[model samples]
Target: MNRKKKIKQILKQKAKKANDKLNPKRKPRYVSKAERARQEQQVEDQ
Candidate 1:
């Protein structure tokens, strides 16, 4: 019985990891000063 419980717990953890990989959360990206300036210039040109 103890072994079965441990196996089930391991399976649950693996499933959770798989689910997380399938549906990832959004994270903010860093923007360098040069890139930001280029973007601003493009907007001004348009």
Candidate 2:
């Protein structure tokens, strides 16, 4: 019973770590008007 409890605790810790990594606070990618113009210029230069 003690071993089973320890295993459960380990599994719970692993799950929490996985969840934290899976959902991270990050900024979404967005292209501004100047950035769009630069990209277009790059394409034209190519």
Candidate 3:
């Protein structure tokens, strides 16, 4: 809420974005609940 805290948070966000850009990480893809259930059903059938 304070000015200093806001500035620090903004700076932290900027730094994080820069770091991620420089050394990007591979994040896993997200599967929805229905898709997950379908996959499980397929596996069970196999």
Candidate 4:
């Protein structure tokens, strides 16, 4: 039982580390059409 628990703990730690490395910390940026238009307007004004 102890050996099984130790193996499970090790596997869980490895999986968590792999997942953290694979996944980004921040969400992706999604620009809406209105935001894009506003940015374009600002560029034109400059």
Question: What C-alpha lDDT do the candidate models reach, one value each?
Answer: 0.96, 0.96, 0.95, 0.97
lDDT (tens digit, per residue) of candidate 4 on 1-46: 9999999999999999999999888987999999999999999999
Candidate 1 lDDT, 2-44, residue by residue in tens: 9999999999999999999999689868899999999999999
Error of 4 at 23 (Å): 0.6
Error of 1 at 10 (Å): 0.3
Cα misplacement distance, residue 14 of candidate 4 (Å): 0.1
- Clashing pairs for model 3 are none
What TM-score does model 4 achieve against the real structure? Answer: 0.53
Angstrom error at residue 35, model 2: 30
**Candidate 2: RMSD to truth:** 7.1
Put down candidate 2 lDDT per residue, 1-46, tens digits, no spaces: 9999999999999999999899986887889999999999999999
- Decoy 3 TM-score against native: 0.51
Cα lDDT of model 3 by residue, 1-46, tens digit: 6999999999999999999899866887899999999999999999
In model 1, the Cα lDDT at residue 5 comes to 100
TM-score: the better of candidates 1 and 4: 1
- Candidate 2 has its poorest 10 consecutive residues by lDDT at 20-29
Rank order (by TM-score, best first): 1, 4, 3, 2
Which has the better lDDT: candidate 2, or candidate 4? Answer: 4
CA RMSD of each candidate after superposition: 4.6, 7.1, 4.4, 5.5
Model 2 — TM-score against the truth?
Answer: 0.51
lDDT of 4 at 36: 96
Count of clashing pairs, candidate 1:
0
